[model samples]
Target: MSKISTAILRGVSGAFIANSGVGKIGMPAEYSAGVQQAAASGIPALAKLPSDKFGTWLGYAETGLGAALLAPFVPSRIAGAGLAAFGGGLLSMYFRNPENTEADGIRPSQEGMSLAKDVFMLAIGLALMTQGDDK
Candidate 1:
């Protein structure tokens, strides 16, 4: 990949993860509600865990993943893989709950849309993985 493209991907994905990590830590009402929704939707275990603990774990994981993607010392593919797993988990939650989507049952509900964007992280992770090949 060209340097410009790589930089853009790194910057955008890094920022996104970083923001999510921070928000998870803060546990703002909206973010907390989203977490609860995830638990209620499919990840029932999350609902059982204390929200503070769950949010803290999520926050740290996201922060580490974001840092890895942003830092030159870390391999992008590895970081991307971690990010992909996280994003996949979120997608799974969305998939498990049709009610989270619109009437079409394809697009996410307004609240779910924020998480719907995590789909891009999966793509980004795949792209980074493919970077092992020469452009």
Candidate 2:
């Protein structure tokens, strides 16, 4: 079995990510468009997909990743890889948008605060990936 700390970390992060994904699954058209636009800034290929389709796909991906993290059967390495990828993508998006950062280009602007908070997800993923068999 995993350690209590690991379990709690995975449970909380997984639930939050899963809930966010569920909320995005049926997002409004405008919301979907906005999300797509932001994502496309980091990954230009994403622009090829329709806004609604991108939103739905993103939701599914997040849900699957969250489920993986929450499942004890899934190794920390695997789950962490998924979380790292997801978190990295979000960070990329945030960095790519000038409006998201301040004049220094590193600090989060008012518009970027939400995305900036995702850094903790990335850190947690890295920590999980580096954990020993105790996980």
Candidate 3:
């Protein structure tokens, strides 16, 4: 990957991650609902956390990850790995709740649509990691 390609990938993924975090802050109702629904996702006591506190902290973490991925000195591969891990967790959450997906499971239901968008993050993450050697 050329520097320009790497930069573009990081910029887009970082912005999306940061935007999602910001949305959690601005849309408390939707954010809280999503958090509550994670109770069956095998995430330990995530749902037990107070909604506001959970949302705030999650927002910070996502925002920080986005920022780190965008930092010039940060290794692209490392950033990509971090983003990929986060995407995996999100994807896991989706699978843990089958009702959120279509009958076929792979296709997302109405509610799972938002979660499905994380595929882009996963792809971008892998792209950054794989292309690191070329930069």
Candidate 4:
């Protein structure tokens, strides 16, 4: 791999691992808090499952992508794209949450931002797919 490609892969991989890892750990608290806060508005329990369950899935997906990126034999792009799609799915629900509005304060809006990162991850994943290991 060229220097630029190496750098790109490293950077994208780093971000994928870090972002997903953080979400994987932080999501339970953040998601539960949101649901708890929004329960008063009657959002229903079922609606919150995606956000609540996202952590486990994100952790697995991120770990896979990290491994793929770091491994000599694994496919980087495929792993990156899969992880990215996972992130995008998370974001789709995040921004759509009725309780997570900008007017409410950072608590709600942060969810939107969190979801947006998923979209970004998806793009990175796509890039990885496009540019697999050169060697």
What are the Cα lDDT values of the candidates? Answer: 0.75, 0.87, 0.78, 0.57
Q: Candidate 1: which stretches are off by over 4 Å?
A: 26-48, 102-104, 109-111, 133-135
What is the alpha-carbon lDDT of model 1 when measured against the actual structure?
Answer: 0.75
Encode model 2's per-residue lDDT on 41-123: one tens digit a residue.
Answer: 98889889988677877888888888988999998878887888889989998899999999999999999999899898898
Give the alpha carbon lDDT tens digit for every residue of 6-49 in model 1.
Answer: 76787789887888787777666556666666755666666776
Instruction: Per model, state how many residue pairs clash.
Output: 0, 0, 0, 3
TM-score for all models, in order of appearance: 0.78, 0.92, 0.81, 0.52
lDDT (Cα) of model 2? 0.87
Give the alpha carbon lDDT tens digit for every residue of 23-128 in model 3: 6664476666577567338365676777656766777878888887878788888899889988877887777778769998889999989888877888888887
Candidate 3 ranges with C-alpha deviation above 4 Å: 23-36, 39-42, 48-50
In candidate 2, stretches whose alpha carbon ends up further than 4 angstroms from where it belongs are none
TM-score of candidate 4 on Cα atoms, chains taken together: 0.52
Q: lDDT per residue, candidate 4, 16-101, as tens digits?
A: 58565556654575764564444323334435556565456556656665666666555665665665665565554655575455
Model 3, C-alpha of 69: deviation from truth (Å): 1.7
